[model samples]
Target: MATDKHCKNELAAPSADQCMDHYGCIYENNHLITLMVDPADGSIVDANRAACSFYGYRLREFRKLLITDLNGGQEDDTGSFLDRALPGGKYRGNQVFHEHHRLASGQHIDVEIHTGAMRILGRDCVYTVIHDISERMRSEKRLRESEERYRDLVELCPEAILVYSGGTILFANQRTEKLFGIVKEELLGRSIDDFFIEKPLSSSEYNKLKAMSGIKDSFRIEQRFIRRHDRRVFDLDISGVPITYNETATLQLVCRDITQKKKETERAVRLQEQRHAVGFPLEDKAVLDKLYIPANTLSGDFFIFHRISDYEVLGIIGDVAGKGISAALSISALRVMFMDSLHSGLAPVEILQDLNRRAIEHMGEDYIAGCCFHFDFNRGMMKAAAAGINEFMYKPGGGEGMRITVKGTPLGMFAGSTFEQTAIPFQAGDRFCFYSDGMELLFSSDELCREYEYLQGKIAGSVLQDDCTWLSLLIT
Candidate 1:
């Protein structure tokens, strides 16, 4: 019975050699410091070679102590590992840093302990992995401090800084929000076009920005934007820079609100209009009527009458493409060219050809349609040259009218084209009307003929709805 009892005890004990053989492979090759601890008394049950080497201890020495002996806390403290590994408790990312543990010879080493709960040997236990991250932690702290300093600098910047990514405003500085009259929360996740009253920047501008990819020379432009609070238009001078953040390309914009400047500009335009109305009266008796219509705040159509040597008069009517300030600028340039060519004593056809050549040279590719008519009263003849413009109407008596056709293309188009000059004998009570296409929309060819017949016998006032100038000369 004694032998049988000894045999049963031997069977109950685990084979140490077999257990070592099975776990030796894991102990030698594993990177993590794997350890198993007792659940009931928090004793060290088993530790791999990695754990012994990481904690500055031999496996045999570690087995002699409880898990709490290695903890920096006192023996009664129970340590954080026991608390986390209790049945039904959660194992969060709990870590302890600079924890000192004793070795066999009483030497101490600093370590970082990461703990999690698991089952070991068919019982509830705590598994821990140790790491020596003292140097890595120092590096991370320095990087975080540098980032904070850079953030502070950006916050104190005076210019309105806007950071955009993927068509949404990701970040905005205090000045940016204040200029747009919107809080940062509202501005984020919104597109730049949301506040812009004018059209968004053109595709060409966007392409140019993509090509530049850095700070460019300052360019001045007028922009219209709406405030969030009142929806009022505010002109702005905006500058932008390109930057890379988090491996993504983005744009940073700095804006200045120029509302006062816009107000001053409008006031100046009104004053100039008043001054022009006062100084330049429509006083030429040869001009029966004139009309002006601007497609926008400014016009591209221009008409002028110059009394050349009392008997001879020159009338010019022209239209440039586009609208607003660009067209206005082109018209001003054309006015200078027209006056220069006329004063040089060139014939009507020669004057138009010279003007076309100069305009093409200066404007480059953009063209304008115009007509010049010279009425030589002393010779009883009216000579006119048309370039790309519609036919001119010459009304004789008894509802008879003839159309003068253009023989050349619009100015600024071809390198060389001939302009045909047509001369008509000036008779008494002959009416000549020169106008833009805007006038033709109101009167068709048949309707104009009827009007001319009606006007042959009677003097009647006509309502012209376009930019028109009619010169009716009655030879005595």
Candidate 2:
């Protein structure tokens, strides 16, 4: 009702004919105390009837009083109020509720005031409406105390908690600030992305998280964050929770720094590497062509080539069960045992038996699939032992390819998985190819077979004769 009367007055000029109609209207007859002040001197220019009655002063007495008298002689108070309520900027809403004023009776009261600059008598002046807000101020003080108590509980929490909005850090507790090496004041206006080592997040990821169902519960993310001082790397296990503040959506982040544990893990990996280097360089002039790619940093595939005599060569290729550094070390131990047995002049079958015995002795329950061959160039014969891996192909005297079939269980798989030795005759121009499962696993079985056939056709016309290596052996 007050707003409607105010609008009518704003649309029509005041005249004697409309004076009686406006007398009891809500705008001119509101209970709020209204005052007009001269901008040049902070003097009380005019006071409405309600203002005169509310401040316990007559209109004649109020005209002689300066506006500063009601403000308890704070010299800069008037200047601050004018700056906030000038033509382009005016104080609005509850922001005006914090000002304190004294009445003519010298009794202080908390008041809510709305103010704006307006033209009066062809000169600039300020118009203000004041409302008593003593009960509202008391309620607000109690609410602030409750919030302070809750904040204290949040600060004492062990988990690192942070509140953020509009990409800026809003609030952080002691644990969070200490972990990040930042002060509360310093982090307030800074973007949260500034503390991350990687790109903060894609727009799609942000939207996905915002739209996720049941977001109030919890969610986890693994990310990299930068330390505040030296910018060192740290891994963060972040838990996000959604909250509303000031009617806007905000995120509460709980982060755990895992830098020390990560460093210890890396150190343990390097030590494992040093221990597995015990069985290096097993043979000389054997031309071992090997390519290793581990799903992890460590692998379980193993290969060894050794010369038993000046005219005889022994080759072994195997893949151990499982993966990781432990499996790789197991394969290394098996290789050492096989090399030791071969150097003692053991037959192909006996060598496999001894290797299996050693594997059973050292390995827990893991097993290895392998094939071994002893080639004698002088006698033009080859002795081979197969266990688990039996499919083989050879080209004798550079003639048509032939497949050799041998059968046995993998070593360490059973208590006594025996192996059999098979012999094959060779010629001067014969070529032999040996491989592990990884070689076939490089491409699909069909793709690899097709590539192999294509390589065979290419080799027919090529004159390149280089030492046998992984890729080079395919060329003539």
Candidate 3:
């Protein structure tokens, strides 16, 4: 019944003749926020009911406020807009302005204002319509910030990153410039295929890149690239992932320089082969047992034994400075020199002096830590000399084990560096052990064979930080 009554009232709406009487009533009751301002003094002349509600101001209060008060000083002088509203001016027609407006609650908001010059009752005025655009402005600001963060991440990445389409380069990060030895300006808009020496993208690789699958869907291959300036070819490990760049389906590539790693790997293989070829010579000697374990693919440690006579064996165990290829090379050269001195019939002390002189002349900054010894089974005597390697275990049969220490500087430090030699009588059933500093020996046990076995097992299971080599002899 109530709905019917309201419909009947709407159908009996005012006639055109009576609508003229509601001329001011329409403007006052309109839902759009509207205002009439005194153009001469920038004062508010009138405000509609919508303006009052939107600004949280009473009609009487709005009439006393200036347009600048609501505009937050955006227009310091109202003439700025009036000057543009004149004929031949930029905003001669209905003018538009984007501004920040201050609300009655002291909050600021973005707004779009549409304004027009008007005359009412023989007085000039400016009619304005305001639209709140605060939400739109906030959304645009967030989008700009997100784009800035993405650009920063790409530029600061350590590995070379690039985006390409159809073998053409679209984007390359800062690291890419350094990797290719080309400036950023030169890298852009270039063909990505030109940089690689390998064949261009394959059909399967392109298909995988276009799939736009998850991260796990990417593929990696080892490729070769030549520097733009030097033209030096180097190895690269590249991973390609399907990505959408600039709203287009494209590929993102991450490249890492693996040239040095490949060289080191090959060098290590060669060093291991050398060690295998130079196997322990005295391993067949019945009274001698030796163990050697390297810390890395290449070792700085080495041991050499030569049978000088039927009852006399000359040997040296040493460690060179540094590791990897350089140290391994040094050990290899040292072994040849040791065999020469052993065949010359030089004593342990004389051999150390000769080796020191050679090391100073040839090794340069490199140094050697070594201990040389001569074992005479028939005479029951042990003669040892020290250079950096100071102490070794010596135990007589049925006697307490003790360390024999002879002080000397490591070889190659000073020219003519003297070494100390110690002669200890070792009879049948006595045991002598020569080892590098890498091994820690207590010499608390008289049973040298058992201790040597235990040390070997322990060293085998442990992770060594340095090369460890030891030789044990049981005089029998």
Candidate 4:
């Protein structure tokens, strides 16, 4: 019966006297600051206990002050605010939020004020509900400072940095602008599709990144990125990760420019292609048949054969110590030295001695393992020298193949190193196969003595699994 009467008195009462008393009861003890003000003249007519406590002023003291007195800034803004809030004596606008207000102690604080029109005791008034937002404003300011610090930190990074959400780029660093040839403003708010040219970035791709399995949730891709203005494609090494940024899920990407490295690789491929022609000469089928494959754009294994005379042909198979373009370059220097002294009528050991001197002068300390041989058809014999190299020969005249292990210092290692020469008589039924270390892995020790077709079957494709070379000096 008491609840029914209380509800009836609070909700059903329509008289101004009862409504004013109910409103007073609600606002007087409310936690939020409340004030009744005369809108026409910006005069406070009444003040709640919360308002007095918040502003450090009693009701009589507050009634003497205007609403503009509470505003921290000049009264100009308050005038405009009141004009907007109470246009034509009606409160139709949104509450003025994030406004700076002052307390009676002169301390400034952030506030949000709700304004609404009402009539109390036959007089027009506005009830103001004030919310202090000092804590929220301080948090937002700190967050802004933290964001600025992070941005400043990545600004010095050489690689481009980007932060995105849902495939939409939200933040891009200065390097990102420099990389994409676009301004910071242009990169911001752009989609991932604008930069990547390999495949279009969509929701599915973003989801895949988010769903990537790992504690850190990261992935890397080496591909291409297109510049927006010039449409220039850059070889890019890109990595992405799912991270928490500003309490929201985000994807951060770091892109590095590898355009120069890509160009160098392409040039190496061209050099390997050109070197393939001269590296193996098929002009003399009666001499030898050759096979060569590079593990990469540059071959570490190389060979060259040239007929020194009508009866004498000199051949050398070498495996440089390392892989890639560095080894390729060293071998190229070795080739130049060998060819320069080829017709000098020097012996096989003397030729290697001279090549060694040239290699040390030009090719640094990159050691080479190679075998040099001079085949003499007229003499029916082969004079070979090994410089830290091994050569395999299947001599039917001797019943089995013997591996020729050369005992000499590698080229470019020392100045006085000598190549040990061996002279073996050439028999018609004998076959010789020279293979690099990489090629040896594909076949067993016994298989190296078998026919070359046996080894070809193990090769998956035309390309060798490693930097490899094969030279068969068949005396048919």
Best by lDDT: 3
TM-scores of the candidates in the order shown: 0.49, 0.45, 0.50, 0.60
Taking all chains together, the TM-score of candidate 4 against the true structure is 0.60
Clashes of each: 0, 0, 0, 0
RMSD of 2: 14.4
Per-residue lDDT, model 4, residue 63, is 84
Select the stronger candidate by lDDT from 1 and 3.
Answer: 3
Candidate 2 residue 401 Cα shift, in angstroms, is 2.1
Minimum summed lDDT over a 10-residue window in model 1 is located at 275-284
Q: Which ten residues in a row have the lowest lDDT in candidate 2?
A: 467-476
Winner by TM-score between candidate 3 and candidate 2: 3
What are the runs in model 3 whose C-alpha is more than 4 Å off? Answer: 1-286, 340-345, 441-452
Q: Which stretches of candidate 2 lie over 4 Å from their true place?
A: 1-194, 199-228, 234-297, 343-345, 441-476
lDDT comparing candidate 3 with the true structure? 0.75
TM-score of 1: 0.49
- lDDT per residue for candidate 4 within 268-366, as digits (tens), equals 778766766663332442445566777776788888787666767788888887777677677777788789867555467877887788778877878
Task: Residues 1-476, candidate 2: write the lDDT tens digits.
Answer: 99999999899877754654663374357777987777666677777889988889888888887776776756453455445445335434223424677888888887777776666446666777888887888877877787687579879988677776656677788887667777766777676656654535454334423343435565677666666457777777777777764445777878777667556546645644454333323233222223333445455665565656777767676778876546656766786888777755556777788777777888867888888877776777778888776655565553665666788788877777878789887765555555566555343332322334564454445443221112111211
* Top-down lDDT ranking: 3, 4, 1, 2
